[model samples]
Target: MTGKSLADYQKEYERIIFFDQPRKDILLEGLQTEMEKQFKLPMRSKEWKKENQKIIAMYRKIVITRTL
Candidate 1:
């Protein structure tokens, strides 16, 4: 193997998962916008909105970690 550390390898893996792959940004943006409209509040200020963001972020983390 090369001289890179394990953490460096892990970072590369995560980068591939989170950044190298194609994502449906437009769909995600539309969904988030619709959710904000439906809630009538910014996601950071509303309890339900905050919860949804947490859930979405968790899912994103899981997907990236697993895919990596």
Candidate 2:
């Protein structure tokens, strides 16, 4: 996996938050796909556990911040 930088995520988060409801849903799906592609691990695998946690945490943070 080519580790993505914090800035890359921050930028995507910003873009997602700026989108309207329908677009946001689409973007989130795309983001999830991108994450899966980047991680290159099946969702159920033990190896994916830690990264998945981090990704979910970061996604929540972005959504929370957007609401603020």
For this target, which candidate reaches the highest TM-score against the unseen true structure? 2
lDDT of 2 by residue, 1-68 (tens): 56675568767877887788777777766665665567553646666666577765665564555322
TM-score of each: 0.32, 0.58
Provide the overall lDDT of each model, using Cα atoms, as 2-decimal numbers: 0.43, 0.63
lDDT of 1 by residue, 1-68 (tens): 33443344334444444443235343334334443354344435556546666444533443444422
Which 10-residue span in candidate 1 carries the lowest summed lDDT? 20-29
Angstrom error of the Cα, residue 62, model 2: value is 8.3
- Candidate 2 regions exceeding 4 Å error are 1-3, 51-53, 59-68
Q: In model 2, what are the clashing residue pairs, if there are any?
A: none
